[model samples]
Structure formats: structure tokens, C-alpha cells
Target: MNFLIASVSSEPSIDHAPFILSGVLLSLVVIYLASKIGGEISNRLGLPPVLGELLAGVIVGVSALKLLTFPESGSDGSDSVIMWLLQTTLGLPASEVSAVFTQVSDVVLLLSELGVIILLFEIGLESDLKQLLGVGAQAVVVAVIGVVLPFAAGTAGLIFLFGMAPIPAIFAGAALTATSIGITSRVLSELGKLTSKEGQIILGAAVTDDVLGIIVLAIVASLAKTGTVDLGNVIILIISAASFLVGALLLGQLVNKLYVSVATNLKTRGEIITPAFIFAFAMAYLGNAIHLEAILGSFTAGLILDESDERNELQKQVVPVADLLVPIFFVTVGAKTNIGVLNPLIPVNREGLIIAAFLIVVAIVGKVATGLGAFGQPGINRWAIGVGMIPRGEVGLVFAGIGSSSGVLSESLNAAIVIMVIITTFIAPPLLRVAFGISPDLESKELKTEVTKES
Candidate 1:
């Protein structure tokens, strides 16, 4: 016993300990494996892969099984997974472990942020600007109506009923405004109705809704950060956000032209991919520099690149990176969520659930109202169009993450958003099939085609 004690005490002290390289690597392994298994299970169960990834985080996270953890409150906490692993592995104390884990957490969070940027970029890449623009006046009507009603309903409900502060309420309202076209398109393709007129209008309007939603998010985020809402500030945020998108597109087009000239003499494995990444990162950096979300910059970069002559080649190159990083982002989001916050026994959680229920109703009604925007075309089942617009999917999650990160949303509120996303996503496919009077048989190729378009 004496010898053992002496040997243990002779090890490096906490303050002098070296970084635990193994801990960092092991964390990655755990996160990736957990995410992969969860995603696969979710897919098999007919749910969005993101939902599974999130659940994986919860399953492995501190609030439940404690498989994954960070300091409960901030970088200073000793209870996180990183701290525990480093403490045990390196024979360091909890406080000393934080120094190293802080770096690790920052890396993970940065990668997660990058994941969303890539997500937005992927959305932009799959889109056809000309097709989007040609969606007609009816799509515009539907898109505008769809965005407005939801924003108004969500904001009003939160303020009048929930009594949430105005800034946070605005964020909540903004979260309600997102529509995931990817899910809608896939369901339409499954029904073999992707090429139909109603499908076209829904697709067009959903895409338009995304643009409007992001703009709203930008405004809300700006207000949240500024801690006050003023007309001049609102106008400036709008102008800056709009200008960044417009300017990025214009500059990207010019750069792409120059890139074509330079590419003729270039030969490298990552020739196309490298430049694309630089453009995206540069834009993201610029957006954040200007007090806007980096997603806007990356999204505009995608729009610009999609118009390039070499777009197909670039798309192929970017997929591998996206596949690797996007899941990490989703998994991190899940890991951060504390499922315990949603317990109905908790008064805040109970209140949040009630608000969430109301938000869902508003979400449904506001989107359903868009079907009426297909006015003058009585042949279209307007209800089906509305159903198609219901799922918020990844976009809603992204918005919620932003709100939570910016401190505009409480944990209970975030849980409510998650519940809203789950309900909307789960209901969309079946409701769409019923509305279209189609069989439930889904085509693998159709799903694949939409996936291809998205990447």
C-alpha cells in the first residue's frame, strides 16, 4: 500500500499535465458511432435521420445516461464528458481538465456551426435559380402568405398567451416560419407527383419561404444580440443582410468567371472543391464579421456556385465533406439538449408544452392558408399544398439551435421547438399521401432523385 501510494503521487500534477490526445480522439469515435447507429435506427423506423441523431445525443448525454457531457453550465464545469475522461485518463483534477476540454469543445462547436453552413449551401446548390424565379405569381402569393401568417401567429401567441419577452418571442416566431422543401419534395416524388402542377407550386413556394424565413431569422438574431428593437436598427439589419446576399452573389459570379480562366492551367485533386470551400468559408466569415449569421454567407455562396458552368463537378466534390460534417452537427445539437427539461412535472416545461401545442396549431393553420394562394386554380387540392408546407425538419432545428445559442430561447422553449418540429415532420408525409389520395408505397429511386437534387 505504501509503495502504491508513492507511485500514484509521483505522477504529473494536474496543472503540469500534458494534453490528453487520446481523449479527443475517443470523443470523436463515440460521437460518430452513436450518431451513425441512431441515424440508421431512425431511418428504419421512418423518421428523419436528424431526429435519430438528436436522440442519440440525448441517450449518450449528461441528462440521461451521461455517456456524453460538458460542464452543465459553461466551460468551467467539471461534470462534462471531456473533463471526466481527461481527469481519469491523465490523472488530472476537474479544474485542470477544463483548460484542455475547452479547446476540444470549441473545435466541436465550430465544426457544428460549419455543418449548418454546409447545410444551407447544399440547399442552395440543389436549387435551380431560373426554375425558382419562374415559379409564377401564384407561388409568390402562397410564399408570402405562408411566411406572414405564421410569423404573426407565432409572435402574437407567444407575447399575448405565453407572456415571453418580445425578443425571445420574435425568435420563436421566426422559428415557426421555416419550411423544409427537401421533405416535401421527397414525399411528392414518392407519390409520383413531383412533376405535377400542384407539386411545382408547393416546391416553388417552399423554396421562397426558406429565403423569407432566413431573412426573418437574421432580423430577429440582430435584435436579440442588440438587446433592443429599434426601427433604424431593424432597417440596418435588413439592409445589411440583404446586401450581403446580393453582393455575395454578384461577386461570386465574377469570381467564378475568373476561376474558369484559372482552372484551365490548374491540376490538383481538390482543385474545384478547394476553391468552393474557400468561397463558402470566406462568405461565412464575412457574414459573422458583419454581425449576421454565417449561414447567410455560405448560402449565398451556394447560390452563386450553382449558377456556374462547373456546378455539377463542384457538387460531386463537396458531397464527401458534407456527409462527414453534417451528421456531427446534428449529433452535437442533440447532445446539447437536456431531455429532462421537457418533463411535464416542471411548471416551465408544462407551460412551454402548452405554448408549443398552440404554436403547432398556428403552424398548421398558417401553412394551410397558403393553399388558398393557389387561387384561380380550383383544380389543385389547396389542402395538400398546405400539408406539404407543414414540415419544418432541419430548418426549424437550425433556427432553434441559433436561438438557443444566442441566449434568446430558454431550454424549455427549445424543447417546445423540438416537439413542434417532430410533430410537423412526422405528420407531413402521411397527410400529403391522404390529401393526394395516393397509395403509401414509396419509390427508392424517387427518394434518391430528390437526395441527388439536394446535394
Candidate 2:
């Protein structure tokens, strides 16, 4: 026992930890700067802040500045400027370059993963389960159509026209199935339509779409690993997803009571916030253990806790943590985005740009068609609802990131996916206002004008 204890507590990594820590700190600094600057600029321009962060990532990533880049083979890929910077800064020789890259990459990636989980948890806190359930059959239809049309159309189109393989094609298709409730809801609230029939329907459908998208993500991620998608595997995945979701919903209820009780009885510094995160992390781990995405677990935990008495307080606490960590996920995604594939100078770049254009068209059309799926609402703005669903936002980026990191997508497809995400997210807010016959720039300008006059 003593020998094992000593070995476990040994400090073999003590010497190397500083460089890795330094690399992480450096990346965080770049991520925060990129996120804040990009978000602020996007906001100033009447665009989604997430769009700015992504564009900022592109600026700092391998596409341009190369300061926030990742390469498969460290500095030797002649591709990883981030690795080169770290090596130079740490004064490491070629022998330690790979080691530094691997350790730093792992640490940064883990943090990014945690960021997404937290982001999902926050989304759940903001969601209203009763409202979602109340949206009823129209929401269910919209969600189903939104998910099905995009996945089927995108996957089939890529296979038939683009001549892509199955796994990567599936990954790309899965990317299309999500609706960013966070972005959509915010815009609706700004427009004073959040509680309207149209807004409620859109929100409910978006929530359902998020859940479906997560399942699709899990299935595709597995298919990406195995490089095949047989009917049996797919059926098994469906069963697993359904089972996990139902189980998590049920389990969350039981755990919430215990969590609330324990938190209430305690008077510690982290009385509420700490227990909340503990529950969130535990659920995330359980989800991963069951072959699902960890975000789904955290998301479900958020929904469960939304029913608690301390929902508002918990949300207030979670936001700061999300503000701290979520940018890492978004910036890293943007940094990994390699836009060089879309360059028109090279012969092959023409095809990439073409595919990207095709993807953009499909992404817009597939999502917009969901608006037509609304039934029996005599005067409801189906156009606005469809437009609302258009922006894939952070959720779409999650799919793109999965495809990029897993090596399941080709450079062209990954770049295409990123392009599609950027365009869809950028245009949705404006298009949604347009659907209601509001000028794309009117609301933003009117708000600023009013604020200035008031001041």
C-alpha cells in the first residue's frame, strides 16, 4: 500500500507541467480576447455575437494569423503555428515539440469539452419544460420536419452529387438538424415575441430539435468511429438514445430532490453553485459512459433542475461559469476552422468553394421548409418560425467541431460545414424580422436611436 501510494503521488510530471500550463494560459488569453472582441463587434453590427467569435477564430486560426491553430503533427506539419509559438516560448527542442503539443492539445481540448457541457447546462436552465410540453402537436411536427428534411436532404445530396463516403456525409447531415434555442430565443425576446404563439412554437420546436440533434450527434459520432452505419447499429443507437433520455429525465427528478435538500441544509461558500455543478458533471459522465454525448447529460440535468425552487439563483450562478468557459469552446472551434480550402486560386479549391455554396443553399432551404410544417394555425407567421430555426449557432458548431476533430470529415466538407454555419447564423436574425415584414436593420437602429434620444 505504501509503495503504491508513493508511486501514485510521485512527481515525474512536475518538470513538464509548467510548460503545458503556460500553453493553456496562453490559449485562454487568446480565446478570451477573440471572443470578447468578436462578440462586441458582432453586437455593434446588429449580428449574432457568436458569429463574431467564429470569425475572430478564423482571423486568429490557421486561416490567417495562425496564432490559435492546431496541427496533426505539431510543428512538423508545417501547419501548426500555435505549436511553433509554444516551442519557441518554452525553449523546447524538436524532441519535446511533439510531447508539448500532445499534452497542451489534450488539456485545451478537455477544457473546451467542459465548456460545451456547461453551455448546454445553461441552455437547460433557460428553457421552460412546461412551455415546451404545452406547445403540443404543432411543435412536434415542426421539430420532426426540421430534423428529417435537413438530415435526409443533406446526406443524400452529398452522397449523390458530391460523391462523399457514408460516415462523413452522415456527420455533415447531422450538423444540419439542430436549432439554436439560445440565439433564436434571444432575438424573439428582443422583438417582444417570445411569449407569442409564433415564438412559443419556435421555442418548443427548437428545444425538441436540440434533443433530436444530440441523439443524431451521438449516432454519427459512433458511426464516425466505426466508419460504417448499418441498420442494426442505427437501430441500437436509437434505442440507446431513447432509453438514456428517458432515464435521465426520470433520474434527474430523483437527484434534484436530494441535491436541493443537501444544498439547503448546507451553509458553505458554494452552497448552491457547487452542488449544481456536481450534479451536472455527474450526469455528463454518466451520459458519456452510456455512449451518448456528455452535453446531453448536462442538458437533461439542467431541465430537471429548472423545476426546482432555486432555478433563478442557479441560473444566475451558472452564467458566470459559462461566460468563463464557453468562449474556449467557441474560440477553439473558430481557431480550428481552416478556411483556406475555400480559396479560389487553386484548381481543387474551386470544387471546395462549389460544395460550400451548395451546402449553404441546402442548409437554408432545408431549414426554411420546416416553416411549412406548421398545421392548423390560421394566421400564425410560419415564415418567422422557419427563419427563427435557421440559425444553427453554437449547436451547429458543436457538430462541425465533432466532425473536424474526429477526422470523419474531409477538409472541404469541414470548411463547407463551417461556412454553412456562419451564413445561417448570420442571416437568421435579420431574416426572421424580415418574415414579420420588419426591415432587417430597423429594429437594431430603432433601439439605438431610442436609447440615444432617451439618454
Candidate 3:
């Protein structure tokens, strides 16, 4: 133990004892407070609370406040004390502690995945399947175009501008493919368009976009790992994803049927909610094992359940859990981000930033055209559809995290991706309002109408 301590000390300035205990406690409190304040501010401005939460994170992180900083090799920085303390408490090497922190970040990420899945499930549950079917082709077209264009633009631009190696650039483009459906959903809900036919198509298309983005991420990850993009692997992933969806739907139907039988016969709830949660987690695990995103599994579980009968009850129960866990995911996402890494004082390459900027533009423009994919749908403005798809939120951050951990993205690239995420999230609300021509007073009336209609 003494030898180990000496070795650890030789490498860095971490004191190991007080740092670990204090850091964890401090991090939790800061994250909670930041999220609360950020969420409240965001709601007041008609923005997704996530934007506020992230901004709060930025405020607390190294960028503005300089309150927290991750330690770097040979850097004489104030955050080094905190970083050292974390290293010592974990009783691991500095690198190992960083790895552990990254893993913990994944737990938060998993919950974020759950949040998006639930959001999508809610969309599916509320949807008129018949109406969705009618607009399915249009949604598919728009989603595909929306995904394809941005991906191509981002990949090409990164290759040309940043001279990034092929695989990393491809990963960057794949990262841009994600659309934050929650952003669009909230905006539409505010605009009183959530029940509109266009709204339905947009929601459906956003789902499609997310699924496609995940596939692309998997492919990019595989390519980065092996230095080859295998057609067979891509085909297999697609098949697996499709199979997962179908299997989930089938299982959901079976479960719903069984529940109906039992409920009708016994007139008991039968602790169905617990099993539902179990099934959701199980699906998420299975998805990970299959090299697909866990969110897909959670979403499939939501789609499979008896929405007609249990939707409200399930939402009420699940939302509280989502509320508690999901914010940690977002706040942790902010915590992991170190904006000081972007400072010119840092001896990092700037090419990543240039590539990141190009990709950000591509991400923005690509989804905007998805609205055009709403072609021939009455009362649907393609621009609105496109704007709705702009918020990258948690999904984009997930991709960035994957890329960073896998070495497909360097630190500078990761920072750039974080900046892009912030921009995309920040821009969505105001742009959404403008696109839909929704003013404050008009929005108030619409909200009243929705409340009354629901009542």
C-alpha cells in the first residue's frame, strides 16, 4: 500500500484521502442545484429545461466559474487538487480514476437514454397508429433525407476542411445524424400542434431519425475499431434493429393480452408496473448485447405495452423515476464537459474545432430539410418539421461520448461536439417559435385550449 501510494504520488499531486469523499459529495450537490436553477429558467423562456441544465453545468464547470476542473498531466492548475483527491480516494491510478468516472457517466447516460425512449414511447402511445400509417411514407422520406444530407455534408466537410482521417470524420458525420425528438415534441406541445397531423409526422420522423443515427453510430464505431466498414456487419445491425423492434412489439402485445386476461378475471393490478420496468431494463440490456442502443429496447418496450389501457398510469409512475434520474444524466453530461479545454492556453490542435463547426452547420441544415420531406401532407410546413428536428440534446451527447471513449474523437473534437450540442439545444426553442409563428400570447391561448380539450 505504501509503495502504491508512493507510485501514485510520483505521477501526480493527488492527496487521495479527502479528495474522493469530498469530490463525490460536492459534485452531487452542485449538479442538483445547477439543474434546478437551469430547468426553472429554461421553462420560463419556453426552452427545454435541458438547455438550462446544460448552461448551468457550463456555469459551474471550468469555463465560466473555474470551480471544477479535471486534472491534466503536468499542469499546475487549481483543479489538480480536486483531481488528485479523486484519484487517491478511488485508490486507482489517475488514468483508472478517469476511466471509472467515464463509466459512471455511462450510468447517467443510460438514464438519459431511458428519458428519450419514454419520450418516444409516449409519442407512439398517443399516436393514432392509423394516422401514422397514412403518413408513414412521408415520415420515412423526410427522415431519410434529413439524415442522409447532413451526414454527407458533415463527412465531406470534415474530410476536406479538417483533413481528419476517414473513420473519425465518418463518426463525426454520424454524430450529426441524431435529432433530439424531445425538443420537437415539447415545442409542438407548446404550439398546440402535438395533435396535428404534421406534428404526428414530425414525431414519427424524429423516431426514425434517432434509430438511423444509432445504426450509423454503430457502423462508425465498428469502422473505427477495425479500420474497415463491413457490409455484412452493417446488414446484420440493420436486421438486428428491425428484429428488435418487431420482437418488442410482439412481446408487448403478448404481455398486454396477458394483462388484460388477468385484470379482467381477477380485477387486480397484479404488480404489473414492476414487471413492466423489469422488461424495459431487460430490453435495454438485450439491445446493448446486440450492439444496438439500449434506448431502442426501452422504446420498443414502451411501444409494446397496452397504451390504450395503462398509458396514463404507466406515465405517472415512470415519470417520477425519469424525473429524478434523467436530470442526473443531463447534469453529469455537463459535469464531464470541461470548456477550459477549448482555451488557447491549451496545447491542443484547432483543426477539430473547424471540423466541428462545419459539422454543426451540417447538423442544423440537414434536419431543416426533413420538413421538406413532409411533402404533400396537408397543413404541414416542411420548415417546421426540419426545425423541430434540430435539438441534439442527450442523444448527440451520447454519440460524442462514445466517440471520445473509443478514440474516434480526440479531446479537442469532444469539446467541439459539446459546443455543437449546446448550440443546437440553445437554438431550437426560439427557432421553433419563429418557424411555427407562435408568439407568447398566442402560445398562452394554445396552451389553454390544449388544457381544456384534454380536460
Best by lDDT: 2
Q: Estimate every model's Cα lDDT from 0 to 1.
A: 0.79, 0.83, 0.67
Residue pairs with backbone overlap in model 1: 60-68, 69-81
Which candidate achieves the best TM-score against the true structure?
2
How many residue pairs clash per model? 2, 0, 3
List the candidates ranked by lDDT, beginning with the highest.
2, 1, 3
lDDT at 318, model 1 = 80
10 residues in a row with least lDDT, candidate 3? 69-78
The candidate, 2 or 3, that scores higher on TM-score is 2
TM-score of 1: 0.88
Query: Can you write out model 2's per-residue Cα lDDT over 13-113, one digit (the tens) per residue?
Result: 43567777887788788889999999999999988788898899889877788667676312342355666676677775566666776777788878888
Where in model 3 is the C-alpha error above 4 Å? 1-23, 62-134, 195-197, 218-228, 259-270, 306-308, 344-349, 377-380, 438-455
lDDT of 3 at 244: 72
